[model samples]
Target: MIEFKNVVKKYDNNITATNNISVKIKPGEFVYVVGPSGAGKSTFIKMMYREEAPTSGSIIVNEYALENIKSREIPFLRRELGIVFQDFKLLPRLTVFENIAYALQVIEKTPEEVEQRVSRVLDLVGLSAKRDNFPAELSGGEQQRVAIARAIANEPSILIADEPTGNLDPETAEGIMEILEQVNKQGTTVVMATHNSFIVNEYKHRVLEINGGKIIRDEEEGVYSNEDANA
Candidate 1:
């Protein structure tokens, strides 16, 4: 589970990216983070993985107190989390399998274990047939599928995606959404930050609406709109 208490992140120029934010995302929960551009959504998610440090307050992720965790401990903490982005972020030169295997290889997972996990995730994402393809050889949707496979390649407890569907067509985005939903069902906590209201309305989840670095609304079965979000 992830919990934040009275968190605030202010940059050197005195602009506060997150202002006294707090929330909890339970294990196995699928949540959508919605708001306009620069609403602090990305900053909020980044803090969970220690990609950005908080100037004040506490962020507890799967029992790791990010506020006090040592730098040496970050890699261990990251193992519990998976991250994907708007851009596919794949290594263009690496094959789909190699891209995913790199994550485990860095952590020194045994070759057998790495091969087993990579094969499983590739099949899970319906990309087993394309395992040997490089990023340039695939379609956009296929590339994203490979990205998703690489992200969960390690069986992370929480998966964070930022604007995952930003570059995909609606049909393709829906495919990605379905894959994410399936991942959630199998027990990974999913937190996605997106601007697609259509997708937001189609899939009801715990919605957190943030604006001006403040969480203005937290709702179960939340829909997307500017009514409360643009404030």
Candidate 2:
């Protein structure tokens, strides 16, 4: 579970990225953080993973107090999270299978255990056939799927996706969405920061609309924007 209480993040030059935002995300829930560019969406998501610590406030993610957690402990905290980025951040030299296996390699998993975990996640993302392909060899959707596979290979309790479909075509984006949906269905809490209105409206979930560093609206099963709902 994730909880934020009076979370305020301020940067240099008197800029506030998050302003007294307090929210709680329960286990097994899919939540969307929808907002305009520079609306503090990325900053908000980064805070959860401790990429950018809050200037002042409390952020508890899966029981780790991020505001004051030691640097060494950050790795432990991240182990409990799966992060998928818009740009597929895969090692170009590594094949799809190796890319996923790399994530599990850091842990105490044996070679057999690594292969099994990689195979399971690749199967989950429907990319088992492309296991030997390199990132450069696959299409955009395929690479994204590989990224998702890499992320979830360790079975993190929480999955955080930041603009996961930003670079894909409509059809490809939908395919990616299906994979994410499947992941969520299997009980991983998903928190996605996205600007894709079609995906948000099509796949209804709890929506947190943020702007000017504040959560303006929090609606269950909400649309991408208020105007879309009215229209």
Worst 10 residues of 1 by lDDT: 222-231
Per-residue alpha-carbon lDDT of candidate 1 for residues 115-175, written as tens digits (9 for 90 to 100): 9999999999899999998999999999999889989998999999998999999999999
lDDT of 1: 0.93
Q: Give the TM-score of candidate 1.
A: 0.97
Lowest lDDT 10-mer window, candidate 2? Answer: 222-231
Segments in model 1 whose C-alpha atoms lie over 4 Å from true places: 226-231
- Report clash pairs, candidate 1: none
TM-score of predicted structure 2 = 0.97
lDDT of 1 at 59: 94
Query: What lDDT does model 2 reach?
Result: 0.92
Q: How many residue pairs clash in each candidate?
A: 0, 0
Q: Estimate each model's TM-score.
A: 0.97, 0.97
